[model samples]
Target: MISPRAPRADRRPVVRSHHGRSFTDDYEWLRDKSSPDVVAHLEAENEWTAHETSHLAPLADAIFDEIKSRTLETDLSVPVRKGDHWYFTRTVEGSSYGVFCRAPVASPDDWVPPAVDPAQTLPGEEVLLDANVEAEGHDFFSLGTFDVSPDGRSLLWGVDTEGDERYTLRIVDLASRAVSDVDVIPNTAAGAMFSPDGAFVFYCTVDDAWRPDTVWRHAVGSSSGADVTVFTEPDDRFWVGVGRTRSRKYIVVEVGSKITSEVHLLDAADPMGEFAVVWPRVEGVEYDVEHVVLAGEDRLLITHNDGAENFEVVDVAAADPRGLRDVVVPASTDTRIDGVDAFAGHVVVSYRRDALTRVGILPLSGGIAAGGVLRVGEIVGYGALTELEFDEPLFDVGVSSNPEWTQPTLRLGFTSFVTPSTVLSVDVATRETTVLKRMPVLGGYRSEDYAQARDWATAADGTRVPISLVWKPGAVDESAPAPTLLYGYGSYEASMDPSFSIARLSLLDRGILFAIAHVRGGGELGRHWYDDGKTLTKRNTFTDFVAVGEHLVASGRSRPDGLVAEGRSAGGLLVGAAVNLAPDLFAGVLAGVPFVDALTSILDPELPLTVIEWDEWGDPLHDPAVYDYMSSYSPYENVRSDVGYPPILAVTSLNDTRVLYVEPAKWVAKLREVGAPALLKIEMQAGHGGVSGRYDAWRERAFEYAWVIDTATRGARDDLESSAPVAPTLDA
Candidate 1:
């Protein structure tokens, strides 16, 4: 066992922030001094990994081991449910696999894993379905999203090998208990949807650049010989990503760059042929095509965004693909379209206006404006509405009394920070709602126990960045300082919304305050927010995070030494940069599967994920300006050997395809050799996600919280002393 508090004299000296100058300014100055010729040469040398034994590798490994040993105990996989029963697959007693299922629970206390008999094999418990099962010497499995046929006679699933995202489609006959491989294009199987006619299957696949490209067709019961390439993308610059419409013959492909999108229609029979462009691209603006559905036999309902406003719903009549016309449902900027579900006679539209999401129904025959909007429920957060299928008997039983009796109702699920997920079935006719499922709260937890608030912090450049704070009622005050954890991810246009988590509740129950920094690089405030946090403006994310930390301490919400910063992936980069830029602001840091080597990772176009990420980070190799900008703050390059930084736990996975293990490995090693007290934990079997199963995920959370608690209360030095062994020499 390794201890945490051993003397570390060789730790690199910390680089101090210059007085009267921001870190970003200092970085700009550093970039200006690099010779143009040397910069060009460095840009040309895009090799991500040159030397393997840099001083960082060993220390990273040690830290990874400590975190892994402390945090991971159980395998945490997603739960799959059907009817009255729910099933979860996990590795039991080491390498052996099993499926655990039991009666459905209305609340958390009622939930329990089914008991298994060692001597007897139960139905649906034989071979566990996994995503990475084909990998060597590992019991890893890809639990691909699966769907049962309408008749419930077969199960269709997609599987991936190791980190190779390309999926292999497979089906198993329920009665025969035999698995059959489906004919799918090599590297072309993303989401699989069973056709309404049930004669063929439709699935999408990605191209070499990782952009969605084609949707293929495969006849039922046919092997490799019967598979057909249905729809192929028109060009490399534009990819075809498919969404099913109500009519089985029609599928919508959202095609365009990150800044814009157009919808296209393809004949289900000959999908590979040239598509009829249903919606043409709008110039000089960024738009997203969404909620595409068949409105009627000759009309389609589509949601689109034009540069000046949020998304709006529009109706386009089915015509020659080259001559489609806008029929109805005129666009408006005041109401932002959130969701849509189209049926034969009616279409349900959910939109957000003035912070409230309202649901409305429009009849194809009677224009959308004529059909008065019906209010459903106001929610702080809204997820895209989806339909859930129930057995014939169950569907019929709820027909009369169910508010959704106007038509076969579609269940819409919604949630918020305080509200657990709730499923509601809405009748397309009467617009009535029926509660189906509500996430059960544990005995001690209450929605009113904590309060959620949002505020803005001005960054060093005077940019207003949004921050969400959550703390127990009365726990935060001037006299009593609360331990705080500030989280953020400022890249990839991903939004960090408020949602309930049991693990998070565990922290709140312990009087810990949690805040999420909705920095500029995210989609929380839409496109403009994301634009400011990526590429040349990437440093804004870290600065915004630091500003939020300062606000929390300065506003009397939390103490400086009691604050801990946490983030994963790109956000992990946020965590690393903040700790390095302002170490005294945070007591501890948690960086998981971090993209710390930003410059080196982006420079190499040959790596699996690099080419696809150019749009987000900019092509540093071909552009000198980007190279200099990225290099200035690239976590690995900016590591200073002279500064004393806060203690950090850098978590990563050896098998992660997105952020390679070498990143954390190298970072930890370098930091340790320079005499910084850092820890690293590498999951041997997992990928980008630290763990695969639910139990394992919970244990990992427990370990992380334990570290945070120990650091905030018992003190980092005390915990380090108890865990680390005393050493005279500082050789990592």
Candidate 2:
């Protein structure tokens, strides 16, 4: 219990550059975050991580009261009908946010979500936004556009009291709960929607590098300085957005990056008009879109990737918008599609086959259906379609709230690693289903008292990978290696499926195991496992998460002295490049908000979203072979000051503008200038999905599950030393 003296961080060099090299950063003066000597070195690394883990404040308050007693502190969510209302969200038991409600639709074709007891608040509901009374006097709040409108009597939302992902917007009214003095608007960028006669709203706005690159429109009660701009995206690797078309009939707008996409459509009943595109940014081709209604016309479907490297669904013709054709032609397990919704009777789709997450259901009645044909022995949206069966062999499903394009019902949402997320509804013309809720985990939780499987690993170029796990099954000994905690994030093609976690049942009720590697820059196993782990085959996402921590220490399910790796934000650059490729195969890592100074934020094009992440970390300014492959694995330029590395921590968020609390305050000041065992906390009023209520995110997940179970059972020492400290010094 001693180790305190930490905050050194003063080095100030700063040279940088790209294409024609140049380097020397020395914690680039902690990127001057409004310097009071960089907020006194991040408040002295938050008071030396609160006097070195103030003895895991009673195991982070008994893992934050066993995640607030298996959470269901007054619940609700699962209503969602839309137009004669029903919506839902509620949360109230000592609330720290939730409320957005709705109600009035027990009839006019009511799609049943009311067997009542949603914390007993339904008959005449309404609420529409109360996020703890709009997060009273903020210390980081968040929300970002809750949308409503289309005659639900205006709502739009947005807010953010701190945690810098911009936000603000407003316009409330919903039958006099009043709040609109000329709409408000400010900063922006997290989508906003409405138009289709909810009288204009659109939203988005970010350039100066924060990247949402202009969208605008406004009008509602007007005065965001007369809004307008409608669409801008002058390609800084594309980034603009706008929504509509859950068949409220077109208005999309899109534009993309991280490998091509373009979309654009507009006419949600022509709100101040002008939008068109439907497909035009093809460098590495990617697509998305939904609007259906076939045979009664108006089409679009899309899902694309022209050559179908695991993407196909075609359609086109929002009145022959351009005649593309096919209709779900590509998946022989080359799955990966990921989205498509449409309805007035069927569609769902979502993809990703063998690495799990499915969805299916197509049905636009097989006849001539506008000839956007799935012809040749049609079998519906592919993986032999009509899907929904889920008995868990590694679970995670999707298509959650089907917003009525003439709803026949869809909802769904399942989960796995020991189930508990549930939510069902189904019946898109009798594929039946209907559970309607399952997340009431409260103490007596059991999915057979935990245990999950699926394995794999291999990789040093021979690929394989997979992993998933979870534990408490015989607590530990099926012949050794226990204190695990593998986890990984891979990146952008997201997929980290197998859900469930009442704060991971306080680390599987203490014997701690938890896994999930599923590597290759993520889309689970499709799109060539995220194109072989990103640009220049980005060190195969840190050698496939160091080949699953050396195949969880060669299958004894982890114990290269009890592993302990983690990831966040691009899987914290995949465990900061698998701790410089394998710091003696981990003992503790975490990382959170971590995009570890990737070659000085991808050779800085004015930073934020760095030129739309040049399609996922590649254009290193002007490519000197992407500035030597992002300065050879940029975890703050491959931290090596005489290696002895391991024990890291580093969660961050000084209002993170997406991975920028100066990349983990310069990778924990270069892992405390090489003496290793770094710590750094920082959230100082949150951002980048850090703390915005729920008891400061359940005491930041009980201080990272009490430091990944005290660094995987107290760092069995391979010089990845651990002077036992698990967490403290938190405020904001």
Identify the candidate with maximal TM-score: 1
The all-Cα superposition gives candidate 1 an RMSD in Å to the true structure of 10.7
Which pairs, if any, clash in model 2? 145-158, 317-320, 559-562, 568-572
**Weakest 10 consecutive residues of candidate 1 by summed lDDT:** 392-401
Candidate 2 local lDDT, 314-357, one digit each (tens): 76677665675756545444557777787876677777677888
Return the TM-score for each candidate structure: 0.72, 0.31
- Give the per-residue Cα lDDT of candidate 2 at 512: 78
Please write out the lDDT profile of model 1 over residues 409-518, one tens digit for every residue: 54466566666665565665455666654555545457787777767778888877777777777555536667888999989777776666666665675678888888
Score each candidate by Cα lDDT.
0.59, 0.79
* lDDT top scorer: 2
